[model samples]
Target: MIQRIQTIFLFLVVVCMGITIGTELWEQAVNGQSWKLSAFAVENLSADGEVVSSSSKWYIGALAAFVGLLALISIFQYKSRGRQMMLNMINSLLMVGLVASVFLTTNGLNSELGMEVAGSYKVGFWVILAAMVCNMLANRFIRKDEALVRSVDRIR
Candidate 1:
């Protein structure tokens, strides 16, 4: 039952991510605003500085890819009880990555694109947060399964 819930949650997360991408693209097309790519300076050194930055769109794409991968893994593991536990761990880590990417992209968009794109950022934040909660619940289910297996083994 928990596995089933997790599978559903994963599907929802994928849908949310898709919606986020779609909304952003629609807004850009309707407004006639070109997507801006900007570089952020991570470190400042004398005159020349080392910058580690990615475009707002790139980060959104990355988050979508990560969530999609996790959703696929969840579906694959649905058939097997043992594998679900491992998949849950992977999903949790991916969720963390997704959330972080949302924050990074939100900050980047605010700085590069201004308040005009704030709606997209807000929607992305909520979706990512929901995904995080779902992933954490899935992880808990995995732990519960582990304990159940151990108990059964001991009884036998």
Candidate 2:
């Protein structure tokens, strides 16, 4: 069961979340001031590359960790395909929240720093989106497995 294609996708979801938790999501330099946004904080960096100040965003990291936990749990629930599908749906919602939280953080930082627009996204942000895609693919494959099981049951 662990060899299922969906399992691989689920594993990838976990990997992406780990990266999201550990890396900076966005970066910008304006008015000679630099800033970096990560799951844990929004940091103002001095010209020499030092953290001048930081505002905490621990909730974003918490949400990402929760989503990753759900994916890992879902991977071990292959016996109950329906439940696995439900978990993935929940993951989808949580992933959306993660994205929204990141966006809101960026907006909040822009306002605080008096910037016209937010900076470009970095690896952490994109990786979460990729995780979402992988989650969707895993769900699709789970559905296919469920349908096949139902068909076989009917034939017996």
Candidate 3:
């Protein structure tokens, strides 16, 4: 029952991340605008001062990949308990990566452009943080269950 709930929650988190990334991409392609103000300048940077490559698409792709990976893990978790624990650990790490990316990207944008792009990034940051917390809670519950089973076996 608990595992089912955790799977549902993780699915929701993956969907939310996908939506957020999709929104950012739409903003970039349709509006010709940076998804977040901080992304604007970074997207414009040229490694050699002659070839400008935007990081926006790469970042969005990364998010999409992470979401896809999480969805796959969630689906497979039911088949193997060990895989479930591994997936939980991997998801937690992905959440950490998401948080770090949000902070660094936001800070990079803010320091270079002065808070103009903070709102979008802030929203993404908070959403990812909430997802991270949920993942952590789910992992703890699974660990507790494992411990309980071990204790019961020892008692017998």
TM-score top scorer: 2
Candidate 1 residue-wise lDDT, 44-96, digit = tens: 12223323332334655665666767666666675575677676577667667
Ranking by TM-score: 2, 3, 1
- Each model's lDDT comes to 0.55, 0.94, 0.56
Of 2 and 3, the candidate ahead on TM-score is: 2
lDDT tens digits, residue span 28-112, model 2:
9986778998888888988888889888889999999999999999999999999999999999999999999999888877897
Candidate 2 TM-score versus the reference? 0.97
* Candidate 3 residue lDDT tens string, 7-78: 666666676565545443111211233433221223543333342445543664475467547755665566
Which scores higher on lDDT, 2 or 3?
Answer: 2
Clash number by candidate, in order: 0, 0, 1
Off by over 4 Å in 2: none
Residue 119, model 3, lDDT: 37
Please, what's the RMSD in Å of model 1?
9.3
Candidate 3: Cα lDDT at 2: 35
